[model samples]
Target: MDEEILVKKLKARDQKVFQDFVNEYKDKLFRLAMGFVHDSFLAEDIVQDVFVKLWQNIDSWELGNAKLSTWLYKVTVNHALNVVRSKKKTSNVVDISQFVRESDDGGIEIQIPDNEKNPHNKLENKELAGILRKAINTLPKKQRIAFVLRQYQNMSSKEIAEVMDLSVSNVDVIIHRAKKNLQKQILKLMK
Candidate 1:
């Protein structure tokens, strides 16, 4: 469905449109949230909240200059940052593992190739993904967001710049630095 049509339906309070919107964007929004919040549960909550807010403010959406997706990304980033900020303010030190259900099916699985098919390659790839994630975590907030949007979401520098409300050149610089930092981190780990 075209975005303009979706927005029109959404503004008209069409339930089918709402469901379609969720089905289309939820996973991507969740992934983006996960890149910021780390915890799967928290990420899910943030995505849910973004949708709720979208529905609440549907009538107010200008839909003049930016695309609906750009609005959604901006909202996701703001809410995710708010969660991080609130958590920081509280300074809670609870061990997240205690809250996590460790049942075999219950965690966020980084899906590599099935180990049974190629155990060695699967293991190596999983290790590399872990290294990459850790390197991403070490980046400053802006750089991490820029890198995630560009790499994981396959967004163009211009798209990322709009999402982050930064200049295109600045987004490019941040992504460049993020790659260099990740490389350095990976090299150090290789030692």
Candidate 2:
């Protein structure tokens, strides 16, 4: 369905249209949340909450102000960040095993040839992925969000700027710095 039509139906409280919208974007929103929180359950919760908020505010959404997808991304990111903050406040112990498990399923895995079945190669690839995930998590909040939106979400700088409410140049700079920081952290981890 066209976005305008979808929005119109949503604004009219069409349950079927809202269900379709949720089905279409739920996975994308979940992955975006996972990129921040690194916990599947938490990410799922965040996505659900975002959708609920979206439904509640659908009537107020200004159609031409921003794309619906952009608005969704912005809300997901903000909600995920808040969850992360609250989690930090409630728990000081970092869960190493959770990070290791997340490295495999958080959509940040390094691609390896399926033809290469060597156990050693697989283990090394997993280690590299864990290192990369850790490095990404260490970045400043803005940089990490910008990098995830650009890299994992495949969003352009302009799109990221719209979602983040930043200048396009500023989004570019954040992604650039994020790459540099990730490289440095990965090298340090490999050593």
Best by lDDT: 2
* lDDT per residue as tens, model 2, 84-171: 6676421222223322323555654434445366556555544544565667777998999998887768889988898889999999
User: How many pairs in model 2 have backbone atoms within 3 A of each other, for residues 3 or more apart or on separate chains, i.e. clashes?
Assistant: 0
Counted clashes in each candidate structure: 0, 0
Best by TM-score: 2
Clash list (residue pairs), candidate 2 = none
What is the C-alpha local distance difference test score of each model? 0.75, 0.79
| Candidate 2 ranges with C-alpha deviation above 4 Å | 89-134, 189-191
Error of 1 at 21 (Å): 0.9
RMSD of each: 9.1, 7.6
Scored by Cα lDDT, where does model 1 land? 0.75
Stretch of 10 with least lDDT, candidate 1: 89-98
